[model samples]
Target: MTLKHLIGLVRALTVFVLMVGLASAANAVEKNYTVQSPDGVTIAVQEGGNPDGRPIVFIHGLLGSRLNWEEQTSSPQLQQYRLITYDLRGHGQSGKPDEVEAYRDGRRWADDLAVVLKASDAKKPVVVGWSLGGVVLSNYLAAYGDAMIGGIVYVDGVIELNAALIAPHPEVYAGLASDDLKTHLDAVRTFIALCFQTQPDPAIFERLLSNAAMASWVMTKTVPSMTVAVADSLPKTKVPVLLLYGGKDNLVMTGPSIARAQELNPSLQSKIYPDSGHAPFLEEAPRFNQDLSDFRNSIQARK
Candidate 1:
């Protein structure tokens, strides 16, 4: 072969090898593992991004699984941070104990998180919670405190659930209580649609509905009574907190809750997406991902 042809061949082979290595790295991030909670429940977990990067743990809402954070996980900006997501007990592929006692009280929820952190070997990671996941994080703080986490992120979540604190969404809660499966599914469908400000992508919407339908109705009904108000716990939290919410959210009122959280903990910071609904992370993913990256950086800078 001519010298010029040989040089070109070498360059092409080098490029191909680089591309293969990159693809393998990306595939590595998609691996899934299982961790056993203290209560013996098996939690399904997925980890991705830079192995040496700052750890960020994601907790999904009620009836939602680790799949709920797919957008964030796939974001290029977040690729530099180690991301961990787990299917909470009673949802997704995680263990579902048929007994009401398993769902009652937030101790199991808190303990599940601890087990996931330990199993993943993540230390002082930032914990991000959405919807009911937010409540679960609050329950974690109430039970275990913030010593194990670098920061906390609340995405349209409530620290306290009381009639006097916020208006009731009878229709939303009623859907969970419905006896008929069809009636319950229909209510859940409406509730899911209301969660988005603009029409969601068809595939994502369907996947969300499918996942939501998988949750045990009995466990769903028991969660409210099981979760105690974390209002008092907020004042004691020492880690920095970032609260992200949608201005048009119809499910949980963000203004009062944000104000109350800020009142309780001055270390809290927030961003409101005016045009979005309950799921700001999914609705405005690019912006949400950037905000989260910035928050993580700020926390690291402080250290």
Candidate 2:
């Protein structure tokens, strides 16, 4: 071939490759950052979907991280809204402070959430808190009130550490606090299994178990006694609140937990996933996502 023709052909191929790269970049919709909490813990944050759309912040349960919301984060049906999730102070890639105060203080957890919210620049975002995350939300309400949030969703949330609202699993709890690696690992397995009444796909469960294993051992031992101000917080929240529970939850008591929350806020709304357990967001994601979208829209309509 002539040199000129060879050069032209190579240029054309280069242009084609550049176009493909641009197309791939356009298809990617997620970004990540780290936020420093007031007490200096580094919290990892991730954002996905439409950047300018209304925001929905998801707070995962105990021993979980941003990985817990993959179902919601990757959904095409719910991609219209901006989705934000983060690793709690002691879990996943976030900083794991050795001090008991960092893990056991409700205000510290609340501060971590506050830093994430500020970092996201989410305006009145719908906050979805699951399990231990619900306790963080209650603490946030107690510390900061409802002025910054659009709505709240508590999914099989822990309102308090009260035995009346928590299903008894004494051996499991003690095992979790045990210093022996075998005992703690077994307890983590048992606790995770209890989160799902219908077993998740084996691969999904494995990934979640790995996530749990990454958590700080000190955090697990200290967090059970973490103070929660639900009694003072939920009743005083002016924003719309939702209680989304798994009817068959093996961890938190569904009816009693809901009743306790409702007693505090008479206007609280609730829904139950009859066949699911602690992790309804994972067990029944499509329905949970739809319910979440509808709840956010309802809140917007009222504003």
How many pairs of residues collide in each model?
A: 0, 0
lDDT of each: 0.85, 0.92
RMSD of each: 2.3, 4.9
Give the clashing pairs for model 1. Answer: none
lDDT of 1 by residue, 173-273 (tens): 78777988887888888878878888688999999999988888888788777765487468899999998999988777878878878888877888899
Q: Could you give candidate 2's per-residue lDDT for residues 1-303 as a string of tens digits?
A: 999999999999999999987754454468899999988999999999778778999999899988999999888767778899999989999999999989888999999889889988999999999999999999999999999999999999999989999999999999988999999999999999999999999999999999999999899999989999998899899999999999999999999999999999999999999999999889999999999999989999999
Off by over 4 Å in 1: 1-28, 164-167
User: Best candidate, lDDT-wise?
Assistant: 2
Q: Least accurate stretch of 10 residues (summed lDDT) in model 1?
A: 158-167
Report the CA-based lDDT of candidate 1 relative to the real structure.
Answer: 0.85
